[model samples]
Target: VYVETGTGELVPASLQRAQPALLEIPASLDAYLKSIGDKSRNMIRKARKLGYEFRRLTPEMLGQDIYEIRTSDPMRQGRPIP
Candidate 1:
């Protein structure tokens, strides 16, 4: 199944524990929610109330958007704070 490393890397199902074997089908969202504590869930709710949306990013979309955002110089990128 899908597992996240401690450093926040999303390990694909192909790389999961197969020796002992997991019972359930791999799902990133399910594993992610289980990994976090209750406080995180509360924060997600609070952010959602302020017009935020949650989406799981694909590899291609992540490369274009999130990767670009992180690598870009904050001074050069003038996106308004929401």
Candidate 2:
């Protein structure tokens, strides 16, 4: 058996097939949050209350952080790096 999946409905039509799903990209973060609704908002708020935070990495920290995460167990298990 074989299976394939990807974005863009037009690509499948070129091959005489139809994609099972359509992708939608939100215009902004606010649009994304509104689409997911209140439950997700509450969960994010609770996580923040518990001291979790998210932000972009500083240039000085980027290399070390990327190397650490790429070598970590979770990333290795998901897909081994050559």
- The per-model lDDT (C-alpha) reads 0.75, 0.75
**Model 2 TM-score relative to the real fold:** 0.41
- Model 2, 72: alpha-carbon shift in Å? 4.4
Instruction: Give one digit per residue, the lDDT tens place, for model 1 in 7-73.
Output: 9998876753557755664478778778778999889889989989977877886677876776666
- For the record, the alpha-carbon RMSD of candidate 2 to the native fold, in angstroms, is 8.4
TM-score of each: 0.33, 0.41
What is candidate 2's lDDT per residue for 1-82, written digit by digit as tens? Answer: 3334555333322443666687799999788889996999999889999999998878677888877876775546567675
CA lDDT, candidate 1, residue 64? 73
- Residue pairs of candidate 2 with colliding backbone atoms: none
Whole-structure CA lDDT of model 1: 0.75
Worst 10 residues of 2 by lDDT: 7-16
Model 2 ranges with Cα > 4 A deviation? 1-36, 58-60, 72-75
Question: Which residue ranges in model 1 land beyond 4 Å of their true spot?
Answer: 1-26, 55-82
